[model samples]
Target: MRRAYSVETVRAAEAALMQRLPEGELMRRAAAGLAVACGDLLRRNGRVYGSRVLLLVGSGDNGGDALYAGARLARRGAGVRALLLAPDRAHPGGLAALLAAGGQVVDGPDGLGVLDLVVDGITGIGGRGGLREDATGLLHTVTRDRTPVLSVDLPSGVEADTGEVHGDAVRADATVTFGTYKPGLLIDPAAEHAGALRLVDIGLGPELPEPPDLEALQYADVAALLPAPGPESDKYRRGVVGVVAGSERYPGAAVLAVAGALHGGAGAVRYVGPGADAVIARYPEALVHAGPPSEAGRVQAWVVGPGLGDGRGAEAAVADVLAADVPVLVDADGLRLLDAETVRTRTAPTVLTPHAGEAAALLGTAREEVEAGRLAAVRELAARYRATVLLKGSTTLVAEARDTPVRVNPTGTSWLATAGSGDVLSGLTGSLLAAGLAPRDAASVGAYLHGLAARHGSDGAPVSAQDVAEGIRAAWRDVRAG
Candidate 1:
């Protein structure tokens, strides 16, 4: 798992580490690491000698890292030039080091056409908004599509904590972050600006807190979380998912949801909706029920609201599921029926899956606000609803209530944006809930598997929701093999 800390937490850790060390000791360690990363990049481009490197230096410590790294590069025969955004306020020690090493402070992008690498140090973690006027001009004057740029700490202009990129931000080939990974480096749209990332340890880990602010699961982590069948496991012993989905108009949603549940490690799926005929026709293995979910026999968990329209029956289904003692996953149309009373009053664990539009509706805010500030929006929804929330977008984020870390899904692709895809995700998550994983774990694991399955189904081409559901088995095999 890749853990990310907030800017405040990072600052606290850095402060604690710095207090026990000599003056400028932390900066030197950071600079040395930065120099090594630059050296590797220079080596990849051919050699450090005769290579032209551009350093966009500002007034902060970030600029100090770049200027010092440039000095080290210059000593090895690379032609390094610094373009200071704030010439009067530049790091005095770093600038002196650069000049002593035979590097020059340039008026403009002198070798912009022939530069091999660009180092962005215009803004640090504490910097706010977008690039300053001078920095913006410098960035626009020299940067090209093929340039290999490395950002110091984080790409300048990205919000270090929230991952919100307002106005213009530097787009880098790689980001060399110190101490720990910031939330922005691991999330989009700021994460999109940060390409490859390199962590430079300055011994701040021991000073940091135990739990991270956010986390992204990798293969090993997901593999460990996956539910496995044991020797004594039987149909009833495994888990049963009760699905309340589909209306007369959207019968395909019922079929798609059941299809996802079939591969979610569940023994059986009990589906109760008006689309019983369509579901039974598509999946004969499903235990179909035409009555209300209150009378749908036994089930470990329930997944309500896929294509069910805004009607009295849909309301009853949602109410019944929420009233159950077992865990519940609410998605699609179910989100529309949710109120502060219904959501917060439930004693059982509740997981709400909403796309940006649905989330905006639930929050009584605009969709643009939710999209622009996804982390804040998701976190707020989880707290407000008093339930775990899976905000589906370019990046799928699962935010839980309390002090737990937010789960940022790294496996999702644009191909999973097809119609009914969310419905599939709902069933899979619901089944995982029935399988006894915590609400948070169930949502994260289900999202991981669902996204992986979509990638397999897509294979670089457009894929339908059915293709994604069919591809879940292959994804499962790959996970087990890994």
Candidate 2:
């Protein structure tokens, strides 16, 4: 897993490294890494010797890093020009080095269109919300079309800790982050603007403090975390997922949900709903019950509310799941039907999976607001409900009520938004819960598999929910193959 710590942690680490190193060693390391990355970018585009490069330099150390890097490029025979955002405050040492290396500084953003690359060093870790008005105009003028942008330390205007954009932030083609990955580079909002991310080790590992506040699992970690059935494990031993979903109005949801449950490594799936007959017709292995949840046979965990409308039956089903002392996953209409306080009081772990619109309703905020500061919104939801909240979107974030580190699911694609897809995710996640995975792991693994399945099923085109479910076995194999 690639872990990201807060800005404070990174600063402390940098400070510690500085104390142990010779003067200017760390900055030289940063500048060297930047030069290498920029060179790689030029080589990838089939040129380096004569490529035009523009450096948007500021007053801080970040600008110094870029200026020194621009000097390196200039020495390599590439035409390099620096646009000084803060002329008076420019790094004295960096300016002297650039001038010595035959690099020239420009007074403004004019005539920057012909450059093949733009290195944004307008702000660094200490930067606050948005670009300064002066910088914003320059960014707008320069960032049209597909010109690749490489940001130093981080993209300007993005909050390093919260991943929130203050006003206007530079959208980079790639970000060259130093020392360690910042929380914003790994989380959404800020992450979305960071097109591609590359970490440049600046030899500050010993100074870095504790484990990160947030993490995104790589394939190897996910592979290691997956559950496998042993000889002693029977169908029942694997796990049982009790699903109270669908209704007279939506029988297909029950079938789809059961489809997901079966593929989710569940030994058995207990269906309790008005759509029992439909679920049985599609998935005969499912034990069907046409009654209330309490009367249904025992199950290891429960998944409620996929295709469930806002009716008495859905409300009662949610109540029964809440009453049970087992891990519960609530989704779809169930999210709209229950009160956050009531769900928070449940004895067992409760995982709520809601898309932006559903989450908006739960928090009584607009979808736009929820999306703008996704990390904050999800954490807020978790704290308010005292449950683990999974905010699903371009970047799915799972936050626990306690101080447990936040998990940002790196999986998911637009193709995964087909009808009934969320139902499959709920069922699959619930099955993981039934199999005894913790609430956070179940949600994260489920999301990873779902995203992989979507990619496998789509084959780069459109796909349906059935395709996604059918492809889960392959996705699981892919996850394990790593």
Q: What is the lDDT of residue 477 in candidate 1?
A: 83
Q: Quick one: RMSD of model 2?
A: 1.6
Q: Which regions of candidate 2 are displaced past 4 Å?
A: 111-113
Model 1 CA lDDT for position 382: 95
**Candidate 1: which stretches are off by over 4 Å?**
43-46
* Clashes per candidate, residues 3 or more apart or on different chains: 0, 0
Report the lDDT tens digits of candidate 1 across residue range 199-274: 9989998998979999988888888988887999877667899999999889898989998998777889999998
Clashing pairs in 2: none
The per-residue C-alpha lDDT of model 1 at residue 459 equals 87
Question: lDDT (CA) for every model shown?
Answer: 0.89, 0.87
Which tens-of-lDDT digit does each residue in 1-482 have in candidate 2? 77788888888888888998999899999999999999999889867798988899989799999999989988998888889988999999988888888888888877665778899999977899899888988877776766789999899999999888879899998999998788888777898888788989999777776667888888988787777889999876799999989987887788888888889889999999888888877888899887688788888999999988865678878887788888999999889877677797888999999998988888899999888888888999999998888889888888899888788888778898789988999998989999989899999998989889888889878999988998888889998888
Residue 373 miss distance in model 1 (angstroms): 1.1
lDDT top scorer:
1
TM-score of 2: 0.96
